[model samples]
Target: SVLEGGTWAAGRRAAAERRPGGGPPLTILSDGTVF
Candidate 1:
């Protein structure tokens, strides 16, 4: 069960890496509210 869970987690991480914009980017906000 633990091994299966680990494999699933690893697969998800690999898929995320393959995405075009896989992670957040640097940004600046003049106002405190982002919305």
Candidate 2:
């Protein structure tokens, strides 16, 4: 589950980077939690 979450987060980050004019900032906690 941890690996899957990491993969999903990475994919999301990649997609966000592809957005035009930049994407909103992401807040990730030290525990791997994102908001």
Candidate with the greatest lDDT versus the true structure: 2
- CA-lDDT, candidates in order: 0.47, 0.57
Question: Which ten residues in a row are the worst by lDDT in model 1?
Answer: 26-35
> How well is each residue in 1-35 modelled by candidate 1, as lDDT tens digits?
99988976875665555445633322212211122
Which lDDT value does model 1 have at 16?
53
Q: Compute the lDDT of residue 9 as modeled in candidate 1.
A: 80
TM-score of 2: 0.54
TM per candidate: 0.54, 0.54
lDDT of 2 at 3: 100
Q: Name the lDDT value of residue 2 in candidate 2.
A: 100
